[model samples]
Target: MADQYAHSGEDKRPTETPAIRWEEPPEGPVLVLLDQTRLPAEEMELVCTDASALVEAIRSLAVRGAPLLGIAGAYGVALAAVRGFDVDEAAAALAGARPTAVNLAVGVRRALGAYRAALAEGGDGRRAAEAALAAARALHREDAEASARMAGHGLALLDELLPAGGHRVLTHCNTGALVSGGEGTAFAVALAAHRAGRLRRLWVDETRPLLQGARLTAYEAARSGMAYTLLTDNAAGSLFAAGEVDAVLIGADRIAADGSVANKVGSYPLAVLARYHHVPFIVVAPVTTVDPDTPDGASIEVEQRAGHEVTEITAPQASVAGAGGGIAVAPLGTQAYNPAFDVTPPELVTAIVTEEGVVSPVTSEALAELCARARRTTAR
Candidate 1:
């Protein structure tokens, strides 16, 4: 069993407990992740001694979210290199651990590239390992900065789209401090609005199959003292019908060249409803999430998960483990098609907000330009 740690103090900030962190102890370097699977109930830390352990955590959704996954991937590479393991193998495994999130692969490649470059420059294993660690730290720092910038851009867009002061934002999944190096993607924007005293309410969707919003987002919101309400995933349409939602904010796992967004499953329905309700449906993500290689929504590979995740209720507090795990919520021999994510085409998106800027009327050309601008800025 992974070791558990309770919050040190009550006065700590809502986001004080970092979702992912790295520590160098006497033994060696270990990547420490705040076990997300046990969150909102128990505060636990999963210490990963190697890339394999980290890979398992990633697969288990113990430390997830698009931006955070990228950070973890980079750190996993650094861990392997620093520990004198096969850097190439570790990078390949981390990158392929989870598909759909382009950031994870991007981060792994960056760290591996740095390590190889150091070797090419006649550096020894230790030096190359240091280079990889530096790359990972740089990516982590950059992601935090990107999160802050995205919040500003997203909040500004929110203000412009809904000039009315008191904004009521609806969000899906668990985009918050748990998801990024900084506050988060869509949830960060809502946090900014709340901090600015312009937010009236935040409606959180209970993301099914895992209930990330109900368990994670609600925990963060409550800690932050934000006015929020949690509703079942299917209850979102009723909220939209009642004109309770002013805008819909969501974070993306991957964004294709044509501005297609692949987010947590059930996001597509929200987009469709947002369009029908004439509400602004915005996607907030960092530029790193945009994948020019994935040409369109059709090309974005959605990961299919085990059917047991749907048929069983895996709560951290559940005492008796059923056949599949937790309590069996479905009958035996029931089969389920559980896709981890769903794609939302560009046409349904009102705007794509990134640290670089917002892309209203999302287009392939505009997304490419945004990615280009971000690269140029990074080069500088």
Candidate 2:
């Protein structure tokens, strides 16, 4: 069977590292980015100077995918305060731009509260901005480190489950260096395994509405020189049915207190199939993404996307699926409910991998204990 991500390996090796950084200007406050929309084709960074630019970046999907969005949101708040905007209003605006990802709100609130405290003691705008920027930069570093930790835990789980010489994994969307400060969540582990000589192949799902897996994951895989193959979302069922899939690892947008996961829209279906196939379904995310505040999966808000996303399709290279089907698939005026994400109950999940460690059973106690251990590791 041809591996899914092989389609992206046309490039012999990856040339650049995927990361978003803070720039310390001589006169102005720290300058950060609003990543450009065109990637793999063109890697551009937006030099942000205001809150509105950051808001537009988040809204336009210029800087998206959950983990990256949260980090960008944190930097946005820091940027706003540095540019002399009201910290409270800046944080609010950043938090409001996206409702689904708990990480975004958490990152904003984390910076906001810290900035507010400094100002309460008569800190100047400069001092406040620096404080917020420091927090934001800290998060950037933390996210990178978290990615590595997730890779370790995910790999350990793989080693435990598969006693084979090489590991084959299937994943949805794009969880790579571009999605985090480090290599990434799910893809990070795959890349780590590849480097460790344990990875046999990677399957990148052509995530619909946007082909993040095809366009982004494939791009990342090509650079890394990893063997990969791309397949349509529907084709995943065929892979699972054929027993070609070893395990499914994906990044999470949000994790409820009870361990129910909210990830890309198609992830829930994959979980259902994983159970049928006796495959492990793993969710990799940072501790920051876990929301104890949202009691369960039902409480986590889902973002409804535009009908156009489902109706129209765009990609760097059009699939050889023939012509005329080239245009939007849905007829005009057709109502489409495109929720950006869907929740998968803990029962469907085999394990949730955090930077701290892999937690099975996914009970509240297990989840809490895992998180506390992660914090302790970081503290030490």
Winning candidate number (lDDT):
1
**TM per candidate:** 0.98, 0.90
| Root mean square deviation (Cα) for candidate 1 | 1.3
What RMSD, rounded to one decimal, does every model reach? 1.3, 5.9
lDDT of 1: 0.91
Residue-level error in angstroms, candidate 2, position 372 = 3.1
In model 1, which range of ten residues has the least summed lDDT?
Answer: 1-10
Encode model 2's per-residue lDDT on 1-380: one tens digit a residue.
00011123233343243445667677565444424345556555565667777777777676776777777778878888877777678778889888988888878877787787788889977787778878887888888888888998888889889888488799998888777877889999899888888888898898887777877888888788888899999899999998889999999989988999999889999999999999999998988888888899999899997777777665434552313233567776777788988999999999988887788978888988877876787688
Candidate 1 — which residues are off by over 4 angstroms?
Answer: 1-11
Q: Could you tell me which residue pairs clash in candidate 1?
A: none
lDDT of 2 at 166: 83
* Candidate 1: residue 352 Cα off by (Å): 0.6
lDDT per model vs. reference: 0.91, 0.79
